[model samples]
Target: MVILGLGSNLGNRAIHLKRAISRLSRGSGAVLHAVRLSRIYGSPALTPTGAPAAWDLPYLNCALLGETTLEPGALLRHVQEIESSLGRQDHRRWAPRVIDIDILWWDGCEIKSDDLTIPHPEILKRPFVLEPLRDLIPDTILDSETVEAHASRAGARASVGEIAHSPDADIDVSYPTLMGILNITPNSFSDGGRFLEPETALMHARRLVEEGAGIIDVGAESTRPDGATIDPATEWARVEPVLHGLRALQGEVRSLGRRDPFQISIDSRNPSTIRSALDIGVDILNDVTGFTQPEMLEIAESTDVPLVFMHSLSIPVVKGESIPPDRDSVEFLISWAEERLAEFDRRGIKRHRLVFDPGIGFGKTAHQSWHLLEHVERFHDLEIPLLVGHSRKSFLRTVTEKPSAGRDVETLTVSRGLVEKGVEILRVHDVEGHATLVSRHHSDRLSQLDAGAAVKP
Candidate 1:
């Protein structure tokens, strides 16, 4: 176990922390693996007494927990080299710098050398460090005090608050991720009745996660065009059991030594379903309604679940209707999304907690659906993660002339293309194939990067 602290108070604080994390993961001959990063926290600068208050700048702080095979001294040297490469200039103590990396604790080994110390002395005293550290390792004990207790005591004098993470604090969507579709509706386009039962849904969900799904998108009501829309009570009845089962399965996985957290995304536009899902601890709310209801906004204020605003012409999509081909669909969607984003901003929803889906088949013809996929990267300008659910949609049917069950190949093709264009989340029914493609795509890119770096002057 290697625990490290990263802090930056000058020059693109978030970028500095993110870059350092990447370098740390790749450096040291690939000795480090299984990295767990905490959400960034903004902490007021710790200045000595009599220092000028105007000169102080708050630091963006985060903790990193990873498994590294390198010895402590070698690991320290590797990190020092990373900091130097990231432009850490020598400065007076506590002064703002581009990047600062410190080894908080190393493998429970005590070392008292002039160059390095095993457990950082300031861990117990600084709320900034304790807060992020506690998030990553809540059971950590330092100087006979738990990290949580230390953070609580230190938070009074040293204020620390978590900033919104780009996609989410708990989820890692830095690369193309697999969001497995778990539809419980009898009328859903694919795999509907198969998972309507709680026991069957739990088994399938466990299989999805085991097959490398980063998220399980649970939908009780069918969002398919012309599909039936059930009442909130019916929707909850189909969803509540699955959520509870997955939560229990998560505990079982953890007990069996799997530490990766599986995120739950509830797919519904109903406010009552949203409330119930939040109460059961859903990580994200995927609304096909684009959050039009006042009740939706009210829920946003009441809970902190991240919102997914999908573009659709109607709440329950009307069948056989497509945006007019004569009309510029992309332009209309851009304007419509901008308006929705503005409304969310007005409602005090943080930008980081919001993501947009183009609603591939919701209100678009096969051609119009393809238009959205081709211009998907345009949504990047919105400055939030983009989720594309092109899996087994009708557009693929138009291209391949195949049924929904036979479109997995087309789904992988579309998914790989979206991943290349930097789509953050790929919601698909075929988790294994999508996961494999993403893994290979990233691996090949990394290989090219390494080869290019080796030849550079």
Candidate 2:
């Protein structure tokens, strides 16, 4: 049994809910069981009303119940389609929405995916949703706490009430983590061909480890939009030097003074390259294939290691250094990620061992990138820790009007926003600068948060 809460503040709110439930009942993947809706709650508009008549526009909201066999992600897509069908446009941020459907509970299962989070985040913060949902699933126990108990304990009517994941769900990723990037091509926008020399590459590898990189991502094949592809041998040659250098550093760390047993990651889509890296001792495979490739699944499961699954519009030519997303974007990338994660799970890939990357700067316009960053919190719903790799992206330069040749300062602006959103691993080339900025700002933010929590009336 699953409990879904639905609401709409736009055109014909009640009608939108009715149509949404009807469509969900008949959706290709879901089964509509039963529904218990709350009395429609009306509230003043949150977005400032420019027109004198706009202030009178009140928002309508409600809740629901159902039984379905669809996975969390599949259910999400169906709901999104229903919302769109009911006249919900994915254009506004915090604007009037139509037929917003949220998964309140699913057969007592806990799920966190890139696009969908079960139990619905913000459940503990919205009395409008929780009050009605509580009436429907009167005895729902999430994480050993009753829905009523959970809702009552938290301030459901707080000013900030938008939920990103279920109240009981876990969204914490390892914070202050490190991710060292490797670009295996002669023309990557950043370090293109600079590390081609085995000696120079080895030095870079050692330096990254010394500074503190929990995972070293070695890219043997660069997949920049319309980027060049090489044969298996060429791919292997590029990463081999760096891989060997990492091994040498591993040994030296122990002999000299430090040893973290840092893990090594192979960033590639070719099964052969992945297999070869595995044979030589790679710990993680960052597959941009979206796990659509059968070989990717086989190699990952066979190795029984963790995998970093990244989402892309196409398998190639992520956002070029030439183009980017725009402002006020509506492309909900996290929601999309949830759907992709479901795809991986259906293929027998373990969710716990999987890490999520929002595929920043890949196929996303400038607006899309901002939407991801602004709501990076929404991704915490996936539960698995996340990695952000938007360092020196063209979008940053385009937005900040900084030159892309080396926009370290401009890129840092985005990084700052991400860290505030609780992003775990920051994939970057400027290790020292990132660490410095994070170290300085984290203290202040932590203190401010603590003070806010302590000042309760």
lDDT string, candidate 2, 126-228, tens digits: 5666655555554677668787786666534444534322210011111345677666578777788877777777777767766766667888666666776
Model 1, C-alpha of 93: deviation from truth (Å): 11
lDDT tens readout by residue for model 1, 1-457: 8879988877546545655665665422444566666656666678899877654876777777778888888988888876765668665776777788899986678888898888987778777788767666666778887777777777666523533223222223235557899988788887769888999888899999988787899998887777776999999999999999888877887798643467789998889889988888888888888888899889987776668889888756788887877987777787888899899878877665677888898889888899889888777656566789989988887779888988999988787678656577789999888767756654553353334221000
Q: Which structure among the candidates has the greatest lDDT?
A: 1
lDDT of 1 at 59: 72
- For residue 353, give model 2's deviation from the true position in Å: 1.0
Off by over 4 Å in 2: 1-174, 256-259, 318-332, 442-457
Candidate with top TM-score is 1
Report the C-alpha displacement of residue 348, candidate 2, in angstroms. 3.4
Each candidate: what lDDT? 0.75, 0.63
Off by over 4 Å in 1: 1-174, 256-260, 453-457
